[model samples]
Target: MRTHNQRDAPGLRDSPSEVNGKGTSGPEPNKRRGIRGKIINALSPISVGKAKIKHKKKNEEREESKPITVDQIRELIHEKKLFEAGQHLLMMEKASYAEQSKEGKGAARSEIEAAYGLLKQEALRVIKTSVRMAPVNPELLQNTVRAIAEQVKEDKTAALEKANVLSVRPRLWKEAWKEMIQESVTERMQVPPFDGVEGLSATAHSFLHMGKAMKDDLITVVQHIKPHYPNDFRVCCVYAECYYQCFSSQLEGIAQFELGSGDNALLLTWVQNIYPNEIKKHRVLEKELEEANLGTLLPLKQIKHLEETYLINELESLKRCLARCLQMEVTRWTQGREPEKLDGHFHSELSIDAIQAVYGGQKRAKDITPDLGKQIAPLLLVELLTFLQSYKKELERFLKDNKQRQHFEATVIANINNCLSFRTHTEENTMPGQNAVKHQISVVLHEIQNAGFEVLLQGLFQELQALFKKFTQKTWLSCSSIMNEIIGCASNHMATLRTLKEPFRQAIVEKIHLHLVREHIARLVKKKVSLRSAEQQGQLSQVIQTNAATLHAFCTENGSNARWLEPVLPRLAEIIRLQHTDAIMVEVGGLASQYPDISKKHLAAILYFKGNLSTSETRGILSVLDIHLSATLPPTSLFSDIKLS
Candidate 1:
């Protein structure tokens, strides 16, 4: 043992020189034992203390590595550290899945649901703002969608694992978000100063505006907000569904109400026409909207009711309109007002108005009342036929007293001109009742046309009556100026009638030709000129031939299109000029074949003009014409209209 100062000196206590000295021997046993014991005593407390500190650090590390608690999750969420909160949520779900305690699992499930619910609430608020086209921070929308995606993952995992704990938690948040989409649409759509669709045209116009505005809002969704959503959202389809439901509800309101024809038509127009057109008008929207597969705006049963109701009502309304137009026309006729002409042809607004009424309704009908044009056409035509018959009877009644009226001929001509408009439109048609109506209508128009011609011809013949009586007399030469004078009077009448349209213009020319031929033949049948000499017969034949030539020239120049009747007068003159009865019989056969309506009296007149023939000869000549008289007379017959003495 050394002194205290020497002993306390750090270098002297464990001197490296003394320990490393080669001559140094081991310390005595007692001394070494004492030093060892002292060393063990000093290090014992330090070893124990260090072992406790190592165990305590391990406990702290374990505490740091464990997942966050529910409280801590809430704090992170409140701090807007959603990423860390989401990690905590997943860990909580996994731990809840592993937990065997029902009570503890239930508590964890509740907290997880509560946390997800808060997230969904925030997400929905952003979605609503975005769907409504309100400006929002992009990050909020991104975060919202990310949360939903995670929830979707949880939903899928729960489904795959059949997770009993996750079952207790609210799930299918994606589906819930879809429901929110519908709710958003409903909320946006209900806002309105709604229009009343109680009237006819007003209802259609109002609905069109509504559909257009809705489409515009949806397009705004596609442009501004849909990008923030995932493709699985199918935002377009959901938007379309909500819009369809809203529109369908409004239409149901219309279907439940009692409607008139016009009102029903307007409703159907919106349902079938304007609505479909509006949804498809935007190409971008069309593809998405069709995918939604929204059915018609109204039920089929309701649509059928509206259609039938509209049809029946429209029929009655058009009938009333037609009756009114007819009455107005009759009133005009009674007042002696001439029906108007267009482009030198008679034209009536009644036909236009009649067709327009049906077509206008058909145009508005869209798909409702299929083939409305075909269905409604017959009604108008039948009504018109009835009115025309009544008109013709009224004209016939007026015609008897027409001579006293100053404007009778002009008014009749105007009415005749107007008939063309009706006839041209009312021809062989495919509409119901078209054939029967056309037949009756044609008869009535024909009678009116004939009466009109008689009126026109009556005036023309008056000037030429004295000249016609001079024909077939002894002074009447082969080329008499009387025929020229008659033709001249006819020419003057033709000039006055030139304003008539084609077919009518040619018709009048043909009528004059037939009348002249009939009158010329009538003179020969008078039996005044008995040509006992062949020379007199020859002279009369020459005169007849020359007059026939002159009449034909005048007719063809004035646009007479009657080609078959051209040879009648020339052939008759040939029979007179022929001397042999055999040749004349053959000639008479040809003439009879040409004019099937040639009668026995007409043959006798021709035989009497060539008076040298014996009675047997006359009998023989008439026998050749017998076969033609019993045959059917054509619609256009010349000799049947002639009077035989």
Candidate 2:
């Protein structure tokens, strides 16, 4: 009727309030429309498009006032509904942004900006917590990573579609997430808990525990986080690098501390024995880490410096241990305790302890690196050599005052065995200075053996000297008591001499034989004996021959294998007893051929004792050496040491 027709009336151009004097009739207007009018509106294309556009406009206007807020973003992110939050953020940004030619919706655009900012901050925190905290939430990480990807996509869309009206540019939140790994690892490694393991220092335990924690986390990355991430991320290597850097820094800090030998050894064990062998080369992590191309956790130079420090510390500790062992051994000896016996041989623990201390430290060093072992063995060998010298010196001092002690010879024998044991062990090892060290040890052994022999035969020299002063005189030639007394004095020392082992036993006994024989010859030199006739010479030669035979028999019987000494006295007796110059010349030539070291003083003594050879004959006898002995003496050093004067 008039209602529908009047709405489209040509003169209805006025404002609604003024044009509608029938405004109160609007409720009645719907009732006036019929089925025919509704059908026409629904079927008409223009009216359909207009109605759809009007409906969409009304919904958007309502939504624009309170489109996705910062609080909503915070709640979704907190709930870890990251994909959903990212979707809603995209929608809100698209809604708030104006077209490419116009500025974005003012307050709504600002809200979108705040929401994304909150997202970036929370997402970074999530990444960090995933690394730093335990029991990683895989789903949360997956969602966060996905959401970051979505943000990247949305930012690209925003830049391309609404370039001029862009509210916030791309942040590339994933890169920020990766960077968080370093900061996360640093904080986590700084405070690893004590593992309560036995025999490890706090620093060492910390290192071990942190390393384990890192490995465990990296395993998580390999199994869970890495598989979920795309290949381009190389998430495993990324995690590994962060852990390595943090753990390496921690190692650097631990290395700087003033550590004990045990601590250093433990550190060496971890750095060398465990880190490279067990961790980096682990079964599961090996291939991945190799591809990752992370070099050794420590640089070569840093590791080298650490190895040197550990070696020096170990050597110092070994030196201190040797000194302490020597001190304890001295106390045991001073207390007069019979040295502990092993296998019917006198024994002491000093050598055993010293060997163990040095090689044990060497083993510890080598455990860190073979190069470290090379550095330490020679240094330790030197320390042991020095200890041996100290050992000899101390024993010498002790022997002077304690010769009467019942355990004295036992102590000396035990120490000699100690040196032998040490030398044997030293030679067995292949080290830089092993041969030289062994030689030095042998020298110490020789000195110690002489020291003991000197103590055992202490006062016999004075007695023998007194009696030998009467040599070549009337009373001495008649009496056999002088030689018998010398034999008796020497025989008393032979009891202890048999207790030592072969080489040393024979060496000591020969030293005694040399002492007696040398004294016999030295007495001749001192007396300047020149027998005038055959009867006196025969008497002197007979007495010397009898005494020399007795001495040789005794010396050979009691481990003195010095047959060279045997011929020395017998030949001297033959030379002295001879009256003919040719026979004497033959003997002198034989002696010179056997002992090239026989000097002019020795020939003078022998010739003067013969009393048969004229001065020219003596000169000719000495001339045998010009051809037999060169300016460079032979290596046989026996007679040069005889001291004929």
Candidate 3:
């Protein structure tokens, strides 16, 4: 019987010799030769002729076969036997063509179309079946992708030299990490429970292993990647964290090596620039440092760049100032509990000797000797002040030369006396009371007044005032208590101004008031203006010129009023009302021309004072600024309608 395999060769059983049952019968020689020649012609065409003949033959075979059943096609496809399915379609087409040939060409073509339609439909069914049978293997895919990446990396190294690898290093690192993570997941996820992992259940053990493995890989990636991807702040920070956790052992090896003979100071400076937030903590990372683990984690190269190039000398100087922060062990052991308490011994101020001592203490047995006491002393002192502020409640009251001390006291008393006669606080003085509560202001005004203290009371207030002034001039390690003291001293001094001589009293009072105005300007500008700036100095001069009028008014309200203050009133008035008018107008004009980034509350404050509004009304005007005029303003003038006093 003929089978599907028999279809490969036609008429084998029906040959003349086979039908006669003659196994060795010879055909007529010429006839056999003609048949062989015809066969050779057909075979030669099969080797070289148009592909259409094979297609026609296939179509004929399909026409003779039954139409493919959807289920049978699905089984072949699901088993991934697509070639067998195609053969079955061809057989069916052959059967159809052979049966329909007697009909017209149109009928034969229609039969061929039917067979083709069945084939295409069955192909789609097989596709769906195969897709459903495919296994979900993300791990396998991930590993395969990783293998491709590794191959690419090696190829790149071969094609492009290893020395120029930085160009592709970041991408390579990212790929490597991605691959490592995938591999870790696969290993931990696919692996079954084994001996020595008995404590954890299957699910728990899998997760634990995966987590630990991932952590290690992440840390490794970060350690290698952090120095390269600096602009990516997120990655750098993540790497920093991972370095601490995953590759801690590797980091410990790094720590054993000294930062070496490079410029540590410069390196520190760079660390501050790039990793400013890290330095903002004031403590260094344990792994990146040697000695007492106090140095910064920044590399030497970065630090040198900062010290050599960055603008803003103040910030750089500020960093230098911070480095001198007192080490607690030496200070507490040698100088006693406080700097003030160490009166008999040489003070632990920021001198060259002091810095050396602190540095030496950290080294246990090593000596750190620095020369040049004059310069070193001041630097060390500044450092100590910053450091002390970080740790303690108050700074030591350094005793200046007696003459200088007297001068300092005069400056304080004169300013305070001036503010008392000149400036007025419509609100209750809350600043001094607050400082007293904070323990920053040591002696209260009431206590001094009760004791009937005159010179001593003035001295204490002046001392507080001088301290506040000094604090403002430099960068302190901390400002909480220091700020409270300055605010309190100013409040108390303003309350006491009229009690002092008129000349000194009014001048001091006006200077204090001008400083407050300047403070507002500073905040608005988002930049520092030294007290010596021409604009600020000019403002102060005008405030002094205006104080005579303010002082007279205060004296008139408070007592039989000093006539001395009255004479200077016009001069003061002219200074405030006219000379500064142009400058004030300029600021206002600028604000009018361009919307300032400053808070409207501050803008409205300057406006309120400019209008000479009453204190109660000034706050109300500011409230309007905070609520209504802040973010949006109509093009119409804000000040055009409001009248100035």
Candidate 4:
């Protein structure tokens, strides 16, 4: 039989029966003999050749298992095969781990680890080089960062430190910051609404915490990144939003109070303090944005849209606050509560504090330092008009039922007179309440003119006619008092009354003229004057002259009504001169002679009146006047004897 070492080698082995029968003792002797045989075989040339072949194969396998070369990694990176490059790095790490685990291979393991480290650094260098060549390739930087992060997970602290440094790059920092904001926004949206007061308080606290956290993050990012991209719109927006969120949280907490109750004062105070600061902050940001030339990074249209949105939100919130305050004050006034002190003055019914607050807002609006003021001015004006309108209705209803209407009317007239006398306040520091009151009066006058001044004038004209119908000293005095009040009010607000001046003057003139005409006709009917008598004609002419002189005196005394009436005084005089057909014909002849260019319509207007002459008689008078007037004209003229009929 072959020796055990030779038997075990080259597929040779001991027989099964001999192996079983030998058991423990037999195996010990066989093991010693096999060791000697194995030594002899290892020294033999054939065994040595086999061992060399095996060792060579093992070396080849080890070489095959080695990490990917720097050249291969560079090729992958160059081809944009970032995933493959990452995989190669992972494999290198695993190979390093394997080498470290092997027994008695400490030196080789250390060498492999060093090679891996160098390859990793080289891979990162290649990635960074690629990025430098094409710095806009965000994918390259992202992949490289992710690979390094993964490889260095065991040393997370170092990895994080490295990441923080890497984020200093503008593109990298912007992307990271944007992602952070987006995540916060998404998380905020997903937060469920709370139910009760306690729940709401909890929610508010949570929002406050979140706002603080975000603000801190924003501060950190901006401190690090602003130097590189000072004009970056997104970064600037983040900074703005951070402040906005903090303020909003505080506002939201304040908003939890019932605004319609005793908390209104607190709410108003908070709003008054916050709104101006918010506007100032916005203005400063706007200036900085301009200085940074941020318009290039952010399109003008988008920036404008964002700014408008922000301003609109702020204005809307402010408007709500103001409206709530006004409503609360109105409620208080309606309930007969003592009025709040406004500018050291207590008003009984007027919500003077609310008015001052609104006026303050208007002054801010007029300043135009904040561009939102332009948009807000109109809204505030609407609110003021609405407030005035409601007050006017209340006053009308009060006067309708109250026994002291005369006293109220006298007080209002006196106030108006006082206001009119002072063209402007002598003191530079006019009280805001006083200014607001003046502005309120002005707006009220303007609105009255716009809404229904004509209607009011028409009603007054009718009232004057009714008073003239029952001509007595008491009635005339009453009419005069009404006229004085109306005229005084109009004169006090002349700028606002300018538009209705002509209509007002016309109404007055027509009313006075109608009175004069009715009186003249009544006198004639009373005298029963027969135009056939020269004496009666003289008497009628005298009546006409007296009435005309009275009208002239009335118009002259009332200068406001004289503007339109003076131009028509001659026509009135001519009308008054004609009491019968012959007199009308003669008067028309005199008018035509006085005005050589007078037309037939002019003669008819001068002669015509409602019950003065029959149609045939009037036609005959016009025909006779035309003939008489035309007879004086030159033959070449168009009017010379042109068919007087």
lDDT score of residue 553 within candidate 4: 62
Query: What are the per-residue Cα lDDT tens digits for candidate 4 across 406-491?
Result: 33332222212222112222123233344565466566644433333333334444554453344332332133444344334333
How high a TM-score does candidate 1 get?
0.76
Candidate that beats the other on lDDT, 2 or 4, i.e. the better one: 2
Winner of 3 and 4 under TM-score: 4
The candidate 1 region of ten consecutive residues with least summed lDDT is 25-34
Clashes of each: 0, 0, 32, 1
Once all C-alphas are superposed, what RMSD does model 3 give against the true structure?
29.2
Model 1: which residue pairs collide? none
- Report the C-alpha lDDT of model 1 over 598-617, residue by residue, as the tens digit: 88888887777776889998
Candidate 2 is scored at a TM of 0.64
Per-residue lDDT, model 3, residue 390, is 40
Ranking by TM-score: 1, 2, 4, 3
TM-score: the better of candidates 2 and 4: 2
**In order, what is each prediction's RMSD in angstroms?**
11.7, 14.0, 29.2, 23.6
- The deviation in Å at residue 333 for candidate 4 is 13
Tell me the tens digit of each residue's lDDT in model 2 across 352-386. 88888877977777777787778887887788789
Error of 4 at 336 (Å): 16
Model 2 scores a C-alpha lDDT of 0.74
Q: What lDDT score goes with residue 110 in model 1? A: 76
Minimum summed lDDT over a 10-residue window in model 3 is located at 364-373
